[model samples]
Target: MNRTMVTAVNTLGQLHKQVDLIGHNLANAETAGYKSREASFADLMAQQINNYSSAGSEVGRQSPLGIRQSPGARISQTAMLSKQGSLKTTGRPLDIAFTKENQYLKVRVQEDGTSQIRFTRNGELDIVNAGDQWVLATKDGHLVLDENDQVITFSGKVEEVKMIQPGTLEATMDNGQNIAFRLGVIALNKPQYLEQMGNTLLGLPDGADNNINQIYSDLNGARRQEISLQQGVLEASNVDIGKEMTDLMASQRSIQFQSRSITLADQMMGLVNGIR
Candidate 1:
């Protein structure tokens, strides 16, 4: 295949990936705490046309240039947007809104009937049935843990969970952030390292060695305060619908234009072949 065709193919692939990301963002526009991701690309290396200057004895070399085709472009990265999502009020005590500065909540979830912990910024929590017991779960339905390091499962309609005050929640900076309540708090060495387990909850990645006991810490050294939870509110996705729509249009047009260029190139080559 021609070098131009190769470049065109890669460009089209990039466009397709970009469109998919935009569609995903739009689909989750109403999702609580959904963070949109953007695709990034880099230019492929092309052959140097001439050696006008050189450090050695190759100054002003006039030899025929050799073709050095690029390996082709690809989606280099998919960076997650860390911008604060909008806050919405739900008037339900279990609903929580994470502030911009110190966003993220820690929770444990069941993996193959076993439990693991992870952190997320989304604060949507609810109750669900598990093994004949109603358990307090994250909005996505992961079990919530109590002071005893046991999954806090409730049965049937139970009283609302005790609302902890902002003042009561404490933060200790370390390998993982340590969050404290009067009764108990879990210490996370690297909250960001926790893997996403869907439904606004996260779990430890495989091969991780996270212990429940590490979450508690009595040594109150240089630590900041933890984010306090409000009873009746949930955080909405931070995605700007208008901006996303605009980006989507731009990506669509780019793909169309690039595709047309490829078609034109093919037609030009076909015409040349017929002339001989």
Candidate 2:
């Protein structure tokens, strides 16, 4: 009976985490460029006990001559879904949306007093003043980088900026000087290796410096693959609230069922103790 209770308790714990993950998805349903995560469950180890030594005596047995006691179930792994979201036209020139789901924009970030490179799916752009010059950046204020790994900077009031090609920007400066910049974008063949840095920022793993080139490919200039991009547009969050709600209800039911099993185990224990 105690073992039964333990198994139910373990399953309940895993169910709780699954519920929390569902809640997170629902909360981010309106967040721009947010991706949903999914969890998979697996059964724990089981102990098999043989009940009969002579199989010839139980020739008509309908089931196996053994009892299997399983520890419980657990969340095996969680995977991020990288499907492209719906495109929303914002009518703002800086707003950009990547039709390719695997593409990410390169941004310069300051973390722990150290400058580092990060990647993001968020396309909301802003121009911020950095001392003597103004640089293009994300809405979060992370400086956007060009193909040369440098921040896109300009002086004086920005006259106009347009997307001449996929991931390429053309800006007309105040002095009527037209300059073209190819935005730095990387195609992550396997985004599962990326380390989440919060606020939609992702980075390479702790020691993946050597394998970055092998796993990710730069999409710029001649190496640039055909991409569908649109300026003055944004990508909405890919989360589906209806599916998330259904998953939430299912997880809640699992929790309730596990609790009932624990209750039944306790009642069984009481009945056995009362045997005279």
Candidate 3:
């Protein structure tokens, strides 16, 4: 295949991948606590020619110059945008929204008989009966964990649940005992390192520190005062429909132009071969 055609093909493939990412962002525009990803492209290194000496001076001879050929563009990386989304009031007691950035609620999930800790921005939760105890759970039934990294359970029937302050919850039981538990709200050191675990949940990569110590430090400092949690509210996805539509159009146009370039390259090759 011709070099121009090869380059065009590679670029077209990258544009297609970008189109897929845009489609994904559009699909999750309404998903709560969803973060959008932006795709970046990078060009390959240019070809270089070794040192050409001008000692063999031929009159009116031009010096040999290195050829800068672009192999093609490639999807360098897809980075998650950390912009905060708008909050929607749901008026539900279990719904919560974080006013601070890079914060997430911690939850525990049972997979293959083993429990794994996961982090999520979605605060829609409910109460579930796990055997003999009633524990706070996400909508998907994953147990919501407390600061101790243990499942938060009510000692008796929960009569009322209220947020006394950010990262703190107070509940009144039917037996007249009021229990207060600190909500496991944590700030990630590097949220970009978080891996999406489906259902708007993110999991810490293996070997990556949970950053629990950082959370503790923040709680002890004045940063804790900046963290605010709003009950009865949920965060909407941070996707802008207008921007996504513009990106989709641009990608489509680029794909068309690349296809035309490949076709022209093929035709030029045919003409070269036909020369007698």
Which one is best on TM-score? 2
Order the numbered candidates by lDDT, best leading: 2, 3, 1
Give me the overall lDDT of model 1: 0.62
Off by over 4 Å in 3: 50-65, 110-114, 210-226
lDDT string for model 3 (1-276, tens) is 788898999999999999999999999898888889999999976676555546555456575554457879999888888789999999988898887778888899887899898887788888777777789998878888887788899856788788897788888888978898877767776777777787477876676665645432234245556567899999998999999999999999999999999999999999999999
Q: Candidate 2: misplaced stretches above 4 Å?
A: 48-53, 57-68
TM-score of each: 0.71, 0.90, 0.85
Worst 10 residues of 1 by lDDT: 215-224
Better of 2 and 3 by TM-score: 2
Superposition error at 115 for model 2 (Å): 2.8
Between prediction 2 and prediction 3, the one with superior lDDT is: 2
Q: Rate the local accuracy (lDDT) of all candidates.
A: 0.62, 0.86, 0.82
Steric clashes per prediction = 8, 0, 0
Candidate 2 global Cα RMSD: 2.5
- Residue-level lDDT of model 2, residues 1-276, one tens digit each, is 399898999899999999888888888787777788888999899889987668788788787778888889999886778999999999999999888887888999999999999998899998778889989999889999988889899886678999887888889888999888888888998888887786478888789998998768888777665656789988888898888998999999989899999999999999999999
